[model samples]
Target: MLKTLSAYIGEYKKVSIKTPIYIIVEVLMEILIPFVTASIIDKGIQAGDMSKVLMYGGLMLVLAFISLFAGIQAGKYSALASTGFACNLREGIYSNIQNFAFSNIDKYSTAGLITRMTTDVTNVQNAYQMILRIAVRAPLMMICSMVMCFIINPTLSFIFLGALILLGFVLFFIIYKVTPIFTEGFAKYDDLNASVQENVTGIRVVKAFVREDHENKKFSKAAGNLYKIFVKAESWLAFNNPIMMFVIYGSIIALSWFAAHFITDGTMTTGNLTSMFCYVMSMMMSLMMLSMIFVMVSMSVASARRIAEVLNEKADITNPENPVMEVPDGRIDFNHVNFTYKKDSDKDALEDIDIHINAGETIGIIGGTGCGKSSFVNLISRLYDVKDGSVCVGGIDVRDYDLETLRNEVSVVLQKNVLFSGTILDNLRWGDENASEEDCIEACRQACADEFIERMPDKYNTWIEQGGSNVSGGQRQRLCIARALLKHPKVLILDDSTSAVDTATDAKIKKAFATKIPGTTKIIVSQRISSIQDADRILVLENGCVSGFDTHENLVENNKVYREIYEVQTQGGGDFDEAGE
Candidate 1:
């Protein structure tokens, strides 16, 4: 985990190295002040030499300023290194997530990824700053102060050693008791975030259903779970301060009592006793800082692991070396194709599927719910690889083709189309970044979206709300189709994309496809029988098997499933929307 995380600390390594150097210099300077003060007290004040007093006092003041300067520099560098690390870490995780295949993404929830990117990263950043600064400074200060104490008075130094051992035991117990609770607490944050994300995104549905109180209660339960775990962890850690204070003051009193006897016997001078008092505070304070560092590290250990999970995750899909760079045409062949969304699942989404589609042949797919309509089309783009057999495009296995080239050639307008927050033109340009304004308008016209675009006050320049919520469902679908049309792909798969549009507009879109792009293979997955009755061929899917593949007229006479569906829509028994999954 450490090795993986350290890779993101690029360019900030110089600042990370410089921060510790500054801290070490600062600790060394701070440790010398007590020695200088002891000289001023014993050799100058006790001897009636004003010159020695002035010289050592002035030198101490100068050393104090130097220490302060080093401390400020250390703080500056620490901030730079930590914030830069956080920026790089977030960027790396986001970039890696972008490359993850659909199967890999299924392993993690949306809320879990958001928590790792946000709360988890913040915890690690704070812990990293403490490690570079206090973690470095405290140990060096403790060691230097302990050495000075032994040199001043060995007999009294044992009190500090004993106190150190006692505090170590106390802190160890606190850390051990709190770590597991904190680890569990961070996981609870994922649930809490999930609750919030779900509520906010679906707030309209929640309010429409009049479930505000129910949602509030649900959120309260998730929050309460996190609160209870934190209270338990903190209650254990609360022992640290009291135990440290007791050890600190107890050792001070014992050292003062033993040093008084030595001072009276002339074995220890008053100046050395005073310096030991200062060293005692220095050493014990260092231990206190270390305790705080331990607490922070314990809180961040869970976060570090979560972050490493994202960073270390390898994409399940990648382009093979020496790959076929171009798809010759949109002739797709699925031979004995089998796919399961989960690797260990017993059920396959698409099973034993064998089909051969010719270029420029328009195929219509009709199926009941859970009949793998979307899954069948998804394989052509290599969205999810087939679990068995080969899915060939242009006579080449999808795995042998460059991923970008294949995906670009196979444009998909999914059922749940999403539009980003941008102008209408901006969203349309996502289909082809360099497409000219005229090319965009032409695609919109073919998709029947140009009518609405010209109706809006801002036309193509109108700002679209996130998820295209500003437009009607039909408008959103039309805009998405236009965006896909801009790709000019060899194969276009519309997975129930025209469900929201009226029958007239749907007919117009099909007409445009037949007339404008006659050579491109079109796969239309629709619920309506009228939509596919004129297709060159219609595929009937049922229970993960191909029930029929033939012209519509033949299917109505021969295929049982297709005949029933056609009768339902034609005989007023049902409509397209009522038949969908």
Candidate 2:
């Protein structure tokens, strides 16, 4: 995990290195001040020489100013390095997430990824800053102070050694108890974030159902879980400060008692005793800083592991080494394909699917819920790989094609219609980045979206709210259709994308597809029989397998499933799924 996280340091390596160099200089200056104080007291004050006292005092002032300057430089560099490291981490995680295949994405929840990118990365950033400054400074200060104590009087230094042993054991115990709790707490963060995301995204539905109180209770439960975990961990950490203070005070009293006897016996000078006091405080404070560093590092270890998981995750689907660069035509063939969403699953989402579609042919797919209408089309664009057999376009295996090349040639308008927070033209431009204004208007016209565009004040330039929330459902669907049309793909798959539009508008969009883009292989997945009755051929799916694949009239006469659906819809207005049930 450390190795993975360190790779994202990128360009900040120099600043990170400079922070610790400045910290070392600051520690050296701080350590020298106590040594100088001893000379001023013993060689000058006790011997009645004011010149020596003034000289040592001036030298101490110089060291003190140097320490202050070094400290300021360390602080500035640590902040720059840590914040830069955090920015790089977030960018690396986001860039990796963009490359994740559907299977890779399914392994993590939206809220979980968001938490890792934000809260987890921030924790690691803070820990990195502490490691660069305090981690380097504390141990150096402690060791240097210990060496100074030993130089003055070796026997007196044993008292600090015993104190160090006691505090080390106490700190170790506290960290061991706290580490697991912090790990569990970060997992609770994912739950808390998930609750907020779900509530905010579906706020309209929650208000419509009058479930505000329920949502409040749900959020409170997640927040309460996190609160309990932190409190439990903090209760253990509360012992740290008190224990450190007790050890520090006890060591000081012992030193003072021993030094008084040593001074009386002429074994230690009064100057040396005073310097011992300064060294003891410096050593004890360094220990305290070390303890704090341990706590921070313990918390960030969990965050670091979470971040590494994202960075190390390799996409399950990738382009072949020597990939086919172009799609020849829209002719799609699913040759005995078998697929499952989960790798370990026994059941397939689509099983033994053998169907062929010629270039420019219009095909309609009808099925009940969970009958693999979306799953079948998903394979056409290689959104997922088939478990068995091959899904081919233009008689070439889809896996052989470059991912970008294949996806660009086969544009899919999913069941969920999505639009970004931009102008209507901006959303349409996603289909073709270099498409002219005239080209965009033409695509909108073919999708029958021009009517609404002309009615709006700004027309194509009107800003769309996030997720196109400002627009009606039908308007959103038409705009999405227009966007897909701008792709000029060899094959276009509309997975119930026209469900929101009225039947007349749906018919017009279909007619426009048949006329405007004749060479594009069109596949429409719908529950409405009237929407697809005029297609070249229709596919009927049942339980992840094809029940019928033929012309609508031929299916009505020969296929039981198709006859039942036609009878129900023609008589009293029922959907394919309703007829199936």
Count of clashing residue pairs in every prediction: 0, 0
lDDT, candidates in the order shown = 0.93, 0.94
The Cα RMSD in angstroms, rounded to one decimal, for candidate 2 relative to the true structure is 1.5
Residue pairs in candidate 2 whose N, alpha carbon or C atoms collide under 3 angstroms: none
List the candidates' TM-scores in order.
0.98, 0.98
**Largest lDDT belongs to which candidate?**
2
Tens digits of per-residue lDDT, candidate 1, 1-581, equal 99999999999999999999999989988999999989999999999999999999999999999999999999999999999999999999999999999888989999999999999999999999999999999999999999999998877888899889889988998999999999999999999999999999899899999999999999999999999999999999899999999999999899989998998999988888888989999999999999999999999998999999999999999989799999999898999999888889999988899999999999999998889998899889998899999999888999999999998999999999899999999999999999999999999999999999999999999999998889998999999999999999999999988888999999999999999999899999999988788889999999788999999999999999999989888898556455455
Question: Lowest lDDT 10-mer window, candidate 2?
Answer: 572-581
Q: Residue-wise lDDT of candidate 2 within 278-380, one digit each (tens)?
A: 9999999999999999999999999999999999999989989999998999999999999999989989999899999999999999978899999999899
- Name model 2 segments beyond 4 Å from true: 578-581
